[model samples]
Target chain A: MGHVVIDVMPKTEILDPQGQAIAGALPRLGIDQFADVRQGKRFVLAVDGDVTQEHLAQARAAAEKMLSNPVIEDVVSVRVLEADGR
Target chain B: MGHVVIDVMPKTEILDPQGQAIAGALPRLGIDQFADVRQGKRFVLAVDGDVTQEHLAQARAAAEKMLSNPVIEDVVSVRVLEADGR
Candidate 1:
């Protein structure tokens, strides 16, 4: 078994309305020092079978294809936690 | 400076279409062993000023207020890293 965490975010040059709204609300919520907020999506996957390099590669491809909009999003970050090897 | 990581997830009882779709598509993408995928939100904040309990409290409040949907989401987890304290 293994756990994979993926983060998807809009490109830096693009305008993110969700992020803008959150950034605007930060000060009112008492976090005045926060200069910006970039909204993103996170996915946590629980694998039931063997964890292998091929599995990780497949997971990454799956994320790129359906989990995020690659056109607007510039970065896709993945972290593997609690894998069978370690 | 400090870094804060927040994870927000939908309540277990609620139906997560996004998660469902991803889970369904996993096998076709070659991640056949993934039993499920839970969609969530992650925010990484870089604090420029003092690192204090009050600052952490304020950041949490900000996340709850604008970054997460408290009504549908049951979990909000925060982790502080690279704080000035240590």
Candidate 2:
């Protein structure tokens, strides 16, 4: 089985309210000196197959179309989490 | 400055509707090899300090207290994103 993880982050130009909220909350909780905080999404996928190039391609397609928004967010990368199903 | 990322995911016993929703949607988009999928949150923090052990400790403290819900989610890890302001 192939396992993959996709990281999706908002574009730098985009205003991320969720990120802002976290950034604002951090200092209040005593983690001072943080400049900016960006929040994103991570998806872990478990597929019962080998880690072939075709598998990677399909994963990319699915991530681009569904996991992230193209307008304001970017699918930073797709990483192979595991190959031996561990 | 030190940069850190925290990954938070639902506990194995917890019901993750978000992950199920994505797994269900993938087949509709034609990538049917995926069996199960788990969704998580990634926080990218840009802290204005060095990447010392103390920095990591504070980051972990902040993450555990705010970024994750101890009841149903777990803070999988705290990773350093960068150093030397890059």
Candidate 3:
């Protein structure tokens, strides 16, 4: 099995009100130095395959279809972790 | 320089309203089979150093202090990437 890590973020052109709200709340939360905070989503999944190029492609497509909103968000990165063969 | 990827997620014991809201909205958004969706945050930062074990530790601490809420969230993972030495 392989582990896939997907990072999704709002498109830069889209207005992220959620992120803005979080940024506004940060100082009060005692995290003052951060001038801004953009909220996003992270998914870690175990796929039934080895970490190959094709597996990565399939995982990316799965993320695009189910895990992220293409209209407002982008897949920032995809990482596949493989186990050493015995 | 190195790139540090931080994945932050709510503690399993805590209720993630945002994630629940997203999960509730998914079917209407055309993603139907997903029974749940847990939302989290991902941060990618460029640090000026080699990807040493020390760098990873420091990055994890920084993420805990500034980027994540230790009370309700945890730093799931930290990965440091280094460029080829020139």
Candidate 4:
């Protein structure tokens, strides 16, 4: 079986409160010399066979409708990730 | 100048409650024909200039110490993602 990966990130133009929160915490935790930190979500879906264009489209649709909010999230990337079992 | 991507994923051996929840909800939302769904976190860090090996090490350390819990997490990947601004 193959896998499909969905990566969702907030739009740079939009205000990223969650990312800002993390950024605020980083320095307090001793991680200085850091720059902008943007947080996002990743989903890996295992399909029962080789990943196809149809599967990729489905994953993209799922990411848009189910995983991410359109207004705040600007970037969403979809791809196939092969498992180590093979 | 560059970006470091830290991807944290729950250990495959450990129970993934969050992913299970999503898998259970997908069919209800009419998103059938899906397979295993594993959820993770993605952090994109913007650095001032070109990425170096030292930066990658720092990112890895930050990911292990703060971004992910080693007990339950299996995979944490770090890399440099160049920004489009340059």
Clashes of each: 0, 0, 0, 1
**Candidate number of the best lDDT:** 2
TM-score of chain A of each: 0.83, 0.86, 0.80, 0.82
Candidate ranking under lDDT, highest first, comes to 2, 4, 1, 3
Instruction: Give the runs in model 3 whose Cα sits over 4 Å from its true position.
Output: A1-5, A10-40, A43-73, A78-86, B81-86
Clashing pairs in 4: B1-B48
- Please give the lDDT score for candidate 1: 0.69
* Alpha-carbon lDDT of model 3: 0.63
lDDT of 2 by residue, B1-86 (tens): 66777778889899999999999889889998788889988888887765667777877898899999999988877767633211
Q: Rank the candidates by TM-score, best first.
A: 2, 4, 1, 3
Tens-digit lDDT track of model 3 for B6-67: 67878878887876775566556454443444567876544455456765675576677777
Model 2 agreement with the true structure over A1-30: per-residue lDDT tens digits? 667777789998999999999888988889
TM-scores for candidates 1 onward, in order: 0.78, 0.88, 0.57, 0.86
DockQ in order: 0.44, 0.57, 0.20, 0.52
User: Residue by residue across A1-86, what tens digits does model 3's lDDT show?
Assistant: 55656678788788877667755665564544433445577865544555567656755765788778999988877665324200
Of 2 and 3, which scores higher on TM-score? 2
- Which scores better on TM-score, 1 or 2? 2
Error of 4 at B14 (Å): 2.0
Please give, as one word, the docking class of candidate 4.
Answer: medium
Question: Which one wins by lDDT: 2 or 4?
Answer: 2
